[model samples]
Target chain A: MDARPTGFSRVTAPQFDPVVRLRDFTRSFGDNTIISGLDLDIAPGEFVILLGRSGSGKTTLLRTLAGLDPTPGQNVIVPASRAVVFQDARLLPWKKVWRNVALGLRQGDVRQRAEDALREVGLGHRLDAWPLTLSGGEAQRVALARALVREPSLLLLDEPFAALDALTRLRMHELVLSLWTRHRPAVMMVTHDVDEAIALADRVVLLDHGRIVLQERIEAPRGERGQVARALRSRLLGALGGQVLEGPSPAEIIALHAGGLA
Target chain B: MAISHRISASLGSARWLSPLLFLLAWEAGSRSGLIPERTLAAPSKVLSTLLDMAVSGELADNLWVSFLRIVIGLAIGVTVGAVLALVAGLSRQGEVAVDPLMQIKRTIPTLALTPLFIVWFGIGETPKIALIAFASIFPVYLNLYSGIRGVDLRLLEGARSFGLSCAEQILHVILPGALPSLLVGLRYSLSVAILVLVVAEQINASAGLGYLINNARDFMRTDIIVVCLMIYAVLGLAADALVRAIENRALVWRPSIVAQ
Candidate 1:
């Protein structure tokens, strides 16, 4: 056997305050630092949305949080099990829709759980159907079902709704919010859409150059989508450094958009 | 949407028409004396010879002998190849050790080893079967290795995220993902099996289609040779169709291109 080193060391850190926490994290791929000296905390059931540009290391951070890769000491304390929903809705092409949804289920009562999860995602009738026959929205719904069926302590989403059309994305957002309410699992979603971050997350963390540039808390009720969404959209655009041709104050930019200007 | 029926019908027509045209052309060319009639017998003569051979149980006995060799050789090859491919595809060290050996072995002609096989195992069923196994193993190994290793990283990560252990991930993700490619490899392996069988019979055999062809050659019975060749082609096509049927059932979740 070749004596090459493997990075699959299982470390059992103590359970401290938060369900998940990252402290003084640093990661690099051959000199290209994806995350360097980063620290964050997630309350047990807090919904945190990570916002960034395309190459802002949002996905990398989420992957690290999921224990998919090795990180520096004291970086992450991921719970026993977490589930992830990927952007591509990566369903196994040979499995049925139901099988894909119930991917993490053990034997015996797993059938019921899988069926329930499918029903929750509005894919009950697609249980026996082949995965390839599912539409993009259906596939994504199945992927969501797969993750939620695990009943994980933490849920990681990597731009999962980015591929959906506007209507589907909106519907999926509601479903996710509903799931979060029901399951109350800690969710850390990475997305490029600022409005999406504000709409879903309790706290929004803006990432730039692999470092947290800004963090803000959203103090709004979950069910009041219209008022909360509109308010949060305004706040998020400001955080993202929206354009200011006439040097409008941050408040004015929100006003200009809310008032139907440019 | 409605084009499915039309496409199926067109394919159906082509399927029968291709073989019919091939047989008609061969018969016409032979009868027209474009080739020497004795040297290249007509399709009708080959059919008659096949019938006579079947009635006398010569064809059946030869087929049984050949089929036995194919089955035993393919069984051994597939088992070994699958085990090696899985081990290599799973472990980095296994891949490093096995990949180079497979690469070198893949290029070595199966026929080139027949002489050595004869020297070691002797001119009996063992050598012929060994050659068939040698010929059949590589395609299955290459295809399976590629299929297993090429599974999407995101899906693997998703499995891991769900707290699935390595064994669960393999059962739920890797095996299913690799099924389609493995089916393709099985089909290719069957083809290789027949090809090596024919060659082995030609070199040294007292039974099977290869032996029949050899006997015809010795007796100057070109008609028998032509019939054996046709039987070989038919058997190969039938085996391929069987594998395809199995693949279609297994990969039902994989949609046609239009659906994608």
Candidate 2:
């Protein structure tokens, strides 16, 4: 109950074209409030990761922004075109890869557009494969293809890699970054993994009890292994009540792989 | 896939072994006079009777009449069931208005209404086909209602988040999701239609398989009666197999050996 917020600044006029603007957003279920009087903004093409515990309401905020849930009155402003990639990579099992990616596209040449998106996600050869036959990673990749094919100005990802193995999760982080770089959509990813927050986010916001407790802008670039990223990870973890990792740090893992390769 | 194909081929030859043995034992019993021909005709006699009827065109004529009844009955049943299911499945008001009535209809077995139908529509093809159609509605309605309601809420949410219109969601997400169940319903309804057809024809009929069976009953032609029963069995099996074939084609997207 005594979590501290360090190196935190309430974001203001952060960058261009604020695709997301939340003003005094409060959501309650019966007597319990999940999010309370929250204000946040995401600049155009920014990658922001929200980190929290299981009931932290990180996903609730994401769903609201994706228009899957109703906003509290008109306090939320999101672009009409937004897509979400859920934790389970919710592909329709009855649909083929291309058909899933082409689910809601209103334009002609949808198949070709889906194919192009799949090609970008390295799933061009799996256009006709059923979602049930796809491996977990491949299915998520198809989900990514489905989201990106919409050409949304904002992309919401709700722990989309939580189900994958460690290796696949790492590869997905890279794939997601490359896609983000190419498409330049305002991305808000929710995760409990602090290292993942540091690995991909331009800014990391830790939510505890449905309110932003810490909003640390990662001055270090994406994939940076410098001291600031490590400091932010530790601070963010400590702010969430001293969460400690039981595994090797990202640096040691990288060094071990580097030594093995050389 | 190759291994499964070979295994099924071997199993296919073994499939006839039981029926073949049964026919052989029947032939033996009939030859020894241990089995009374009047009580139950031998398999050979039933086969010969079927051929004789086929040659005289009497079997075909009756079969055509029965087939028309079944097809027309099923067509009516499927349309009504699907429409009612959609009305109940898609909207809250529709479900309130339609689902309870269908549920009550489901509880009342269609055969129980035969006397009423006869009194209402008379002892003609209209009443007979009406009975078949009534029998066909429940199976289609029950499976499809469950199917439509059982559509994953997650998929609908996904579709909505991806900007699919409500109608688009039904077309792209709901219908395809419910199709496997709809086909299952159709299979049940087909069997029900045949059953109702048999019962309706037996009550009062001038032509069709039931009439033929009734005529044979008068003269104790067990061979002809056996032939009619076998034809019904074959038709039931064919309807089931046809549904399976449709499933294999339409549901090939499922990750299973049979679907593939």
Per-residue lDDT of candidate 1, residues A115-195 (tens digit):
999999898888998877788889899999998888888888999989899768877887887888899998999999876
C-alpha local distance difference test of each model: 0.82, 0.87
Indicate the DockQ of the complex predicted as candidate 2: 0.77
- DockQ of all candidate complexes: 0.59, 0.77
Q: Score candidate 2 by TM-score against the native.
A: 0.90
lDDT of 2 by residue, A79-148 (tens): 8778999998889988888999999887889999999999999998999989999999999999999999
Name the lDDT value of residue A88 in candidate 1: 90
Tens digit of lDDT per residue, candidate 1, span B108-226? 99899988998899888899889888888898999999999998877787778777799999998888888878898999999999988888877677788888888888888999988
Model 1 scores a C-alpha lDDT of 0.82
Lowest lDDT sum, 10 consecutive residues, model 1 chain A, at: A253-262
